[model samples]
Target chain A: MIEGRRAALPPVARLGDAALRLVGEAGAMFLFFLEAFGRIFRSWGQFHKTVRQIYFIGVKSISVITLISLFTGMVIGLQMYYALAKFGADGFLGAAVSLSLVRELGPVLTAIMITGRAGSSMTAEIGVMRISEQVDALRVMDINPLGFLVSPKLAASIICFPILTAFFDLVGMLGGYLTGVLLLGGNSGVYWYRVSAYLKMSDISGGFIKSLVFGVVVCTICCYMGYFTHMRRDSVGPEAVSQATTSAVVTSCVLILLSDYILTSLLF
Target chain B: MQANTPPDIILEGLTIGYGEHAVVSGIDAVLPGGKISVILGGSGCGKSTLVKHILKLHPVLAGRIVVGGHDIDTLDRRGMHCLRQRMGVLFQDGALLGSLTLGDNVALPLREHTRLPEKDIRERVLSKLGLVGLADFYDYYPNELSGGMRKRAGLARGMVMDPQLLFCDEPTSGLDPVTAAELDQLLLELKKSFEMTMVVVSHDLDSMRAIADHVLVLGAGRVLFQGGLAELEATQDEYLRRFLDRKAQERSTPRLTMPPLDQKMMKRDCGKYLDE
Candidate 1:
């Protein structure tokens, strides 16, 4: 006996479904943010939890962030010196390194690092809670999972990311100074002079704002993915959480890059 | 929990599911106040879905659920939150927060909702833990506890607020029979001592027989039976009988018996192996 084969949907229909799903996800994220932030200013209950999150997401991440920033700064100093030497402008190494660190590398690299460290772990933590039915337990207890779980992390990221980025900038500049002056035989006086002359308030502020935005984006996306790990009925088993964490990390990285470009264009 | 009060929860033509597909539809039942009600069903028959609906986790797809005289579907977010405050739930896995100690886990609800002083909170936490026989295990983390201990701790946390109603999802699913019986006794004791309504979702016949004042049987997305343990025993429904028989089979220990290996069978099969 012959079996009947089924017809597939046209590409247009598939595209429409994808579009609708995207809209639904965006709407969910917005609603989740509204719920989490609504409780942000209303309670003292969250203060301790937020502090705990800051320690986890900010303080614990400091060493790694510092290490990466220092190396990045050194690489920039070395490459910039060689490039400027070609133009007989090697003296501008200080200004170049300082500008790159402040305007782009500080915020971008710090966010990327945190995304891998804090963001991924946040997703895993919440995802485990989801699988373990702890989130549901919170709901059953009349506690808003968002208020209890997501809000603290969100507040922590918002408060700590900018601070961490600033630290990254500071450490990075010191690294560049070490490479450009002590190692490369550049004049320390000229280096400091050029850095001061080239750096502006706008550049500093732009980077700070970018760091703030990236923090919000990373926390929101990662938490959103973890919180909604089991939204669908088919989402079951241990694998569901693993999938959510992967999706969260990939989505956060893509969003960071995309928004970075947009923020850069608007700010500069 | 008030004696002689109307049923704490009333469902009329309630349909529950994710999105458009109805896993359980047209569910109508009234679970009496201050009594233990057990929801029973085979796998995928939507017992958990119905429990979620009763908890107001998702929107009711198609009908009315009146809890404490208010139609749940009509409640706004604030109203829903307020309604939930009076309810406590014990998840299948206990759902204790791993980061917090057992003491802190029980104290979470109080910390979040009340302005009680640290001394008072600590006292209350100890009291709750003592109730669950975990008074000395306060500083232990969730992972540090055994499965039974974890469930007891989860129960302690659930009862922290002394909620008017309690909902337990498969409270004894993974436990050994002895442990399951212990949990059943605990449930019975809680029911008597706390004077709160209980709604338990379980497929365990022994648990239902032990603790259920009212039993609700669900199948094919509908309420197949709603009655007491005696009435369940008297039920003539073929599906329920089949389910009971299947559960009985599952509960029985396996015993293997080998066919006699001497004489005729050995002559026919063993000769080949022996290379005669």
Candidate 2:
């Protein structure tokens, strides 16, 4: 019956319907994020759960973040060295690499990588729990499912994102040093000097702020998608869980880039 | 701790369903306190949906559900939590937290609601697990256990709170005959031992006959019958009689209309490998 009704609608009406649904969903997601965020402080016995989440979301992510950041910095160092050498300005390779990473690339790339690694798993795990009635079980037990599941994740993300971003920035600069000074025979002293000279407290703080925002955004969107897996109109059961995980990863990445743009404009 | 006289669950013209679609409507019944009341129905007849409404998991689309003198719709968040703390629910598949051991799963409510010492909590958890004959398996995770074991573990978790009211959703649906009989016996024993109001939703006639003091029969989007098990068994209404007698409605078409497999459709057939 719903399919028949939808089929009878004109193209314009269907478009409007879709737009309205999008707005409604956005509102729901915002409210879900608020509730989960607020529950982080209100719920009891969260320290252990938050610690467990930190180990999963932060500690376990160290190797991947290290690998990605190193490669990204090396690529930047090599590119900037060639570009600067044209003008005998290779001494500034450190400035270019450090500035770009500390200001933009570090936080953005780390968040995107974490979204792929941990964010997708969060959605899949919670989605399975929702589909299997484990979430409902929590509700019936007088336990707020958000507090029991999502809030600890939110708390862990808030703690982990900035620390990881800082780690990424440091490792990424070392990667630049390895490529520019060690591999390319650039002046090591000049590279180190340029890195320290160009960076400021604002640049580092800006990156941290961006990481914090991205962490909240990714965690919220992923958890929200999973929490409402049963309500997805496109699928049901295990298929719905798969769809939710995919949607969570894609949406978190897109939102990361989009918010990075917005925050860059405002912060810089 | 059980109430001296557990409060009855009263549903007045309750309409239960998913959003914008009513599964069962005009459901009026009383699940008496301290008795095993079974909500009996076949698949998709809204037995579970009715239970969800009564448990306040789903909002009633119409009318009211009063549990233990509290109107569910009128209850605030704190009130709802307070009310839920007094109730326990065993989901069909146990619904144990995958990350926690069986002991921790049973110990969850105690840890969450009370500031009991770890030693006392562990002791109580073991006792509940023992009641379900799973004390030896307290270290096991939900995935490690068989379906019957999972259901029993779920029962243990449900009873850990010592709730005044307990709800079980198809507790024996997927179990084998022996396991199902064992669960039925467990429910009977629990009822005999505690003055708890028990609401079990199932279609198992044998189990109902074994334990149900009162039964609410639902079908085709409404309540079909609501009374004692004896009255339901003696029911002369055509549909109820057919249901009680385990009779399937006659179908005009053949049950399996598809033709037999065609070997020609197979990509690879090693018919020669089989004995003629």
Candidate 3:
């Protein structure tokens, strides 16, 4: 009734297992590419559905971050004004708030949000595919497993992250307006003008490009972790899938941070 | 094909495996064309591995794999795809993609390998599903289907391409006895109608005996026996006698124990492991 752990295989069954042996070198590579291309092509129609998925996973996940980022901007504005006015320089509040949010805070905060919520689910979804043999089934049918599983999610993230970041930037700026007018007794026009004036095309594009690259890294690492799921002969179960999901998010976030630094350095 | 067509499978010393662990090697068996040749052996006998290589799912590490006139190991990418497009495989777990509806699952091969219009694909998918007696379950996902239905759906997918050679791994492994018998009968019917070359990897004697025209019995790492089914049943070798009767005779012994490992038995295991 309470068997803790069962054995992997009985000896008799192991003695007679027959699997077809792969013989050619080039044939294997060709098969691999064929699968990748097939998966990619078959996923084009599913792309829109994937965008819809992003709308669900990314856009819908934006609400909490929206509240947090707004409050964060307000808090930053109030704090900066208090510190600067001590030196009789509180008027720099607009430039200080705008510069920080545009160049850094808006993108950083949004990235963290997506990475925690949408990013983990994307990994988990793909991880489930890997463990469930959905990937292998694709391979079996001569379809590329990666393209079907990864392309849609990657493409969706590429589209969603920028839009989400823009939303973050917009909301955070509004928070600044509230802090300047309602909380700090300053002109709303000055806050709005200072924020827009400090913004550049590079700031916008850099964040977009960073988020795009982060999407690929997250999906690829997540997909890869799941693909090698059978690494454990004894326990290639759903728990392996959970580990893959965890690894996918952790790896993607780390890669995003590292690459953001590199990308920023290069672009600026 | 008519009943006159000879069974044929060509594996010219076909060897396949991962790094340092050859699963199947030196396989020179010819499973006759247009007939079922069940590769019967104990578990881990490299039967499924051999079927995978023949299907070109795995790369051939050495030797030639000839199926339906093409040397599979030498085919280019397009050529390999062309070859696979014509061969159907039913995996043991009935490995249908969970995301796809049963209809879409069966239609997948046709859609990929052919530029058949969506309407035509639908018709063909439905027809194949019908063949497996799943005419009404087209929209159902794999999880919704019972075990037998899932296996039948897998069969439908494999058969959609109308492949010349069909490789099935353990078609009736976990199903109940009645379901297993029914599956065997269905396979026999499919073979009779399609005239397809079937290479089934299974241990079920009733299934194998019901459909297999030729039997390739593998043990250790060697082709312990390969020939007509009647001959395998007649084989006097201890291993053959033990293997064939082991399951059927389970009630007689009540349990299976290690049968005194000797140098010869150890050599057999090594040979089986080194085979491909």
True contacts kept of each: 0.83, 0.86, 0.41
List chain B TM-scores, each candidate. 0.85, 0.95, 0.84
User: Can you rank all candidates by lDDT, best first?
Assistant: 2, 1, 3
Docking class of 1: medium
DockQ of 1: 0.66
Off by over 4 Å in 3: A1-60, A64-68, A71-75, A178-186, A231-237, B1-7, B247-276
TM-score of chain B of 3: 0.84
lDDT of each: 0.86, 0.92, 0.73
Candidate 3 recovers a fraction of native contacts equal to 0.41
Tens digit of lDDT per residue, candidate 1, span B1-276? 232342478999888998878898888898978899999998889998888888877888999888888888887888777767678888777899998999988998888788899999999999989987899999999999888889888888888888778888898888899989988999899889888889999999889889999989999889999988888888777888888666453446556567656655453566566766
Model 3 CA lDDT for position A215: 55
Compare the candidates by lDDT and give the number of the best one: 2
Better of 1 and 3 by lDDT: 1
Give one digit per residue, the lDDT tens place, for model 3 in B107-204.
87776568889999999999999888898999999999898889888988988887777878899988998888888888888888877888899998
Q: What is candidate 3's lDDT per residue for A1-268, written digit by digit as tens?
A: 1122222446554343322212342254345434543554463566665777688657786897789779877887888878878998776677777667766676667776776787667656656766555566677677655666665665666677777777777777778768866787877776667666777778778767766665555545555555655553435578877776676577767766787789778876
lDDT of 3 at B86: 61
For every model shown, what is its TM-score relative to the native structure? 0.90, 0.97, 0.81
Docking verdict class for candidate 2: high
